[model samples]
Every structure is written in C-alpha cells, then in structure tokens.
Target: MDRPWGVPSPIRPGFAQAETAVPLMNIANILTMLRIALVPLFVVALFVGDGHETGWRICAAALFGLAAITDRFDGQLARKYGLVTDFGKLADPIADKALIGSAVIGLSVLGDLAWWITLVICGREIGVTLLRLAVVRRGVIPAGRGGKLKTLVQSLAIAVLLLPLSGGFAAAGMVSMYVAVALTVLTGLDYVGQAARVWFAGGPGRARGA
Candidate 1:
C-alpha cells in the first residue's frame, strides 16, 4: 500500500513475481521521491529572487544540495537494505535529469547561465537516458563513478550560478561553471564511448534475443 507520502508501505522484492517480497518503503526510494518534489520549490525560489544574487544562489544551492544528499542516501539505503528495484533504477536517473535540467533551463532563461551550457548538459542527459532505455531490456548498468562525478559537478555548477546577487558569488559561479563545462564534455565523451562499446562492439548481442 502507498503511504500518504506516496511511498509503498511494504515494497515487493524484485521485478519478477517469483521473487520474495520486501518493503518498498525503504529510505532510498523515499529520498529519491523527495528529491523530485524539491525541484519545483527550487524553481520558485530562483524566480522569486528580486535581483538578490547571493540569495538566489544560496537557495538554489540548498535545494541542489538537498537533492544531492537524497541521491546518495537512496543508493546507500538500497544497497544496505537490499531494497533495490527496477523502478528505482529507472526513476532515480529520470528524477535527477528532470530536476537538474529544469534548473539549467530556468537559469539559462534568467541569463544566469548560457543556453549552450544547458543545451550540452541536457543533450547528454537525454541521449544517455535513451541509450539506457534502449538497453534496459537486456541488462542493468549500475551507475558508475564517472557518472556520479558528472552529476556532482553539474549540481555544484548550478548552485554556483544561481547566486542571489553578489560579486563574490558571481566569481565563484564562473569558476564552477567552467569546471562543470569540462566535466560535462568529458562525461558526454565517456557515455558515447560506452555506448559504442556496448552497441557497436557487439556487447551482449543487442540487449537480448536479438
């Protein structure tokens, strides 16, 4: 049953019915959902800023930080409590993309960030997500360290760029944005290379029975 908060009280274990049942209300999934919910609040905060750069940055960073915290917690809880699910595998990344991508778009529209930066980041995200969906039927690829690093940098950059209204914050934002750009480029290459190896290199023969 789903709780008032929308979490299933007792999660069924595994994707297949033959698997044993487990509680779905694990901390990880809860945190993942919470992160998704926070995105709107972050957006409102960003837009509400009356030209206060520092205020905007701090609020945005706090939102991103909260999301980041949940990102880590959910994974840790899933692993520790044996509550990992296919739903989680799909929802986590989608939630992340939605949250971060929206922030990027919002910031870009506000001229706090360049459209090209958001474009590059969103492009990679959309591409990777599609690739994952394409290959999901065959096997699951656990999130790797490089992907994690990319997300971390992206979040930091978004936070830095959203400062409310401060010169020091702007300087910091510039530095962070450059770092994020580098990471974004590197990660895009890494994902493309991985896709090549998986699809072109005949890895697993095209996700199953192909």
Candidate 2:
C-alpha cells in the first residue's frame, strides 16, 4: 500500500533545524547576485526624476542588457564548471524575475506600456515561480525550450522599450511585448499541466527529503 501523508504532529517549542549546505562566494553565484543588484539601477535610470534625459534611457538599457548577459553567463558557467549549488538554483530564478518584472512594471508606470499587459505578464511570472517552488521537492521540473524562448523574447522586448526612440520604433516595441505576453501565458499553462501530470503519477511524495 502507498504511504499516506497524514496530519502532522505539533512541533517542539524553540526547535531549530540544521543549516543547509549552500556554498558561497563563487563566481557563477556572484554573477547571479549581480543580476539582482542591477534591477534597482535599471529602475532608477529608467524612472528617476521623470526619466526624460536621453542619457538616462541609454543607461537603463545598458544596465538591463548587462544583467541579461550575466543571467545567461552565470548558468553556463555553473553548468560548465560544476559550480551549481542549492543557493544558485534558488537565487537564479529570483534574480531573473527581479530583472524582468521590474522592467515591465517600470514601463507601465512610466506610461510607456499598458497596465493590463504588465498585469498579465507579471501575474503569470510570480504565480508560476511560486508553483514551481511548492512542487520542487517532489521532483525537479527543468525549464523547457519554450520557457527559454519566452525569456529571450521578453529580454529583447524590454530592451527595445527602454531605448529612447521615435514613436514608430516605440510602437514596434509594444508589438514585441504583446508577443512576449502571449508566450508567457502559454508556457506557464504548459508548466502547470506537466506538474499536474507528475502529481497524479505519484511523483511528489518520492522526493520528500530531496
């Protein structure tokens, strides 16, 4: 018979668990943290003091572009050098969200993009991240190719929107953003559907201590 996940007993008062062994101060992990750090700079350059200066727009786009590069490089380094750690696995996605989420929200707040579009994109991202964490201990659901493609589209769209461009060029960026939003919603549903299948097949309980 399969074991049941029965109700839990009460925890002892003041009990503390052992610390997980998450390595620190590695180059790959540094790059991941750098991406997170860049989000604030990107926001500031894009929105601070009315964001009208051409120089500021250029700075914002440059910061975002650098952050995106680090995102790609960090993962590649981790995989190539066997530097992957629990902390990297957790922090990396959070960093990506901070970068992309901040970009979309900033654009909307600046009246460059529509609020409804931002709502859909950010909602999907935050919801999926939480869902992934909830079921991660059950089994790892690696990023699919479609998910990577969505990231690429989002990066390009955000960069285009950040640039100080003519009205026509800016409108083109909005078109790209809409395409990204479509992919974001589609891939998010795909992920949830896959997780549901895994749960139905008894995959979650198998990795209780993983």
Candidate 3:
C-alpha cells in the first residue's frame, strides 16, 4: 500500500517475523544472555560486603565492565554472522541498559557515585528508551550515530569507574564520570530531538493516530 509520500510503506509484518525465524541461536544472543545473567551476580556482590569495602565495589565494577564488553562483542558478532534478529536488536540494548543502569544506581547507593548523577543518567537512559519505543517505526531512528557514540563513551566511563586500580586509576575514573555525564546529556537531547522530528512527521504519534 502507498504511504502518504506515495512510496510503499517499508514495514511488512512478515519481514520482521522472517528475520526472527532464521537460525538466531548465535554468539551474540549468547553474550546477551550472559549479560542478563551478570545482573544478579553484580547485585549479590554489591550486598555481600559492607558498602564501604573497596573489594565488593571493585567486583561490581568489574562485572559491569564485562557486561559492557559483551555489549560490543554481541553487536559485532551479530553483524559479522548475519545474526541480527529483531529479538537481538530489541533485547541487546535493553539488556545493556538494565545491567549498566542497575550498576550505576547500585554504586550510587553504595556511595561510589553521587545519587543525583546516577539519577540523571539512569533517567535519561529510561526516557530515551521509551522515546525509541514510541517512534521505532517510520524508519526515523535506527540507533543512529550519536546514540552509538554515547553508548561507547558510557561503557568506557563505567569500566574505568569499576576498576579496582588505585591512585592514577582513581583519577581516571573521576574524569570518566564527568565525561559520561556530558555524553549522557548530549545523547538524551539528540534522541529527543530526533523523536520530536519523527513525532511531527506522524511517526511518533502513529499509535495515537491509529
């Protein structure tokens, strides 16, 4: 059927289902499952020791780093192996956010990070995710360039902060913290701006229109 622009609509129900039906059991999905599994282990580590103890904090950070690394590895593997199913596309980022956001909030509660900062970061992450859900159709936002850069920076920042390395590493973590904050703000704004464009284009508000 012709869309408003007289071009055929890009979405077809069967296309996405077909994409999902292919052999999807792959390394990328495995890594995503691994990341999901790490969440509870991370929480357990955080609570196992006194909140002030550096050891537990370091372990939480390390688990966060590994999950972040898996984020990259899974995406690359999916792309390399043609394993990019709709499920993978949807679940990979959500898994990443759940793991990272949890870590950030946990660390903040443990006094590793400032509460407001964690709130801001996590809030933006959730808001942008909802925005994406609102406008996933109409081909407006395809996990565009800015979003990818933001994730990369956020991952690096989180990894550095989680490291048990002392002295110089501590200084590095401080820098990473601020860097992460800045990137989070920029990326959040970028997502909103894009969503606004899509909203105005009848894409974002399509559900309501329907």
Candidate 4:
C-alpha cells in the first residue's frame, strides 16, 4: 500500500513484490530521467561564450528552471499515481543532486558564486547522498519538509545568480544563497541523525515506523 510521502517503509519481501508491480518506466521516472539529461545541456549553456554571455546565461537559467520544475512534479506524480518503484526511489535523488551539483559547480567555475558556498552546499548534498546509500538496506529516507525547502531555496538562489544581474538583485541572490546554505547544513544534520537511528535499529522493519 502507498504510504504518505517521506514516511519510511519496511524493506520486506512483500515490499519488494509490491514495488515490482509498478513499472520502471512510469511518468515520474521519465521526468526524473529528463531532468538528468538536461544537466549536460544546462552546463553547455552555462559555459557558452566565456560562461557569462547574457543570452547564454538566460538559456542556462531557463534550462535549470525547467529541470527544477520536473523535480517538483515527478514526486507528486509518483505518489498520486502509485508509481513509486525502487528505481524511482534511487534515481530521483540522484537526478536532483546531478542538476544542483552541476549548476553550483558551473557557477563557481565561472566565478559567479563563491567556491566556499559551493563547497558547503555540494558537500552537504554529497554527504547526505552517501548516508542514504550507507543505510539503503534499512529503508529509504524520503526528503523531509526541511530538505524540500532547502532545494526550493537553492533553486531560487541559483536562478537569480545565473542571471547577469547586479545591484540589489545581486545582493538578493547572495542572501537567498546564504539561507539555502543554512538550510542545507541543518537538513543534512537531520538526515544524518535519522540515518543513525535507522542504522542502529538493525533494519527497515524497525526503522519503518521511525
């Protein structure tokens, strides 16, 4: 049975069987793959013409925005349509990290953003991703509200920073980025705590209700 979004489910044999009933190539998974595919294209746009050409920057921001939109829809589609499969569980976050990672790294490379900010945000994302993998056998820790808020803020900040803006607009972007970074660190710590609980609980059977 489909549970609420972000709630962990026990990794039982029956859970695997239920997941098998959902095809791998559902709409949600397709959107997720599309988001992943857009990353390289977004990078290309970002780097075109010395990586700061006005038109190219606009194109890159547009591509990033599109990918972010897909990220929003896919999860909702999966839950509403009962299309949540194991592949979706794994690939969705990977797609998110790919898009966000590429954007921030590309921005840093172009000197549009600070390397320290990039390092902190990317570091937290990478660490959380590894934590998830380290405890995959326990259960999937779905993105909580804090995590979702962080992504939303990160995307907004990146979108602003991608534009060739200055003055107050530029300051606004930095402020937003700072908030996103704060959320990133806070949520990362929360996920780590959750993973530790799930880990010491022995398995998903016990972690599910947690």
- What TM-score against the true fold does each predicted structure earn? 0.78, 0.82, 0.77, 0.87
lDDT of 1 by residue, 1-210 (tens): 232332234435564543434456556677878989998888887777463466665777788788767877677666655667777787888888888898889988887778998899888889878877876765555565677887887777776666554688777877887787787778777766666666654454211000
- Clash counts per candidate, in order, are 17, 0, 0, 0
Rank the candidate models, highest TM-score first. 4, 2, 1, 3
Q: Which lDDT value does model 3 have at 31? A: 83
Residue pairs with colliding backbones in model 4 are none
Error of 1 at 157 (Å): 1.8
Please provide, for model 3 over 1-210, each residue's C-alpha lDDT reduced to its tens digit, 9 standing for 90 to 100: 322211122447778754444355566777888988998898787767665467886787777778778877777666654566666766777787888788788778767778988988899988877876776664335566666777777777766766556788878877888887887888788778878888778552211100
Q: Higher-TM-score candidate among 1 and 4?
A: 4
TM-score of 1: 0.78
lDDT of each: 0.71, 0.77, 0.70, 0.84
Which one wins by TM-score: 1 or 3? 1
Best by lDDT: 4
* Model 4 Cα lDDT, one tens digit per residue, 44-77: 9999989989999999999999999999888887
lDDT score for residue 22 of model 1: 47
Candidate order (lDDT): 4, 2, 1, 3
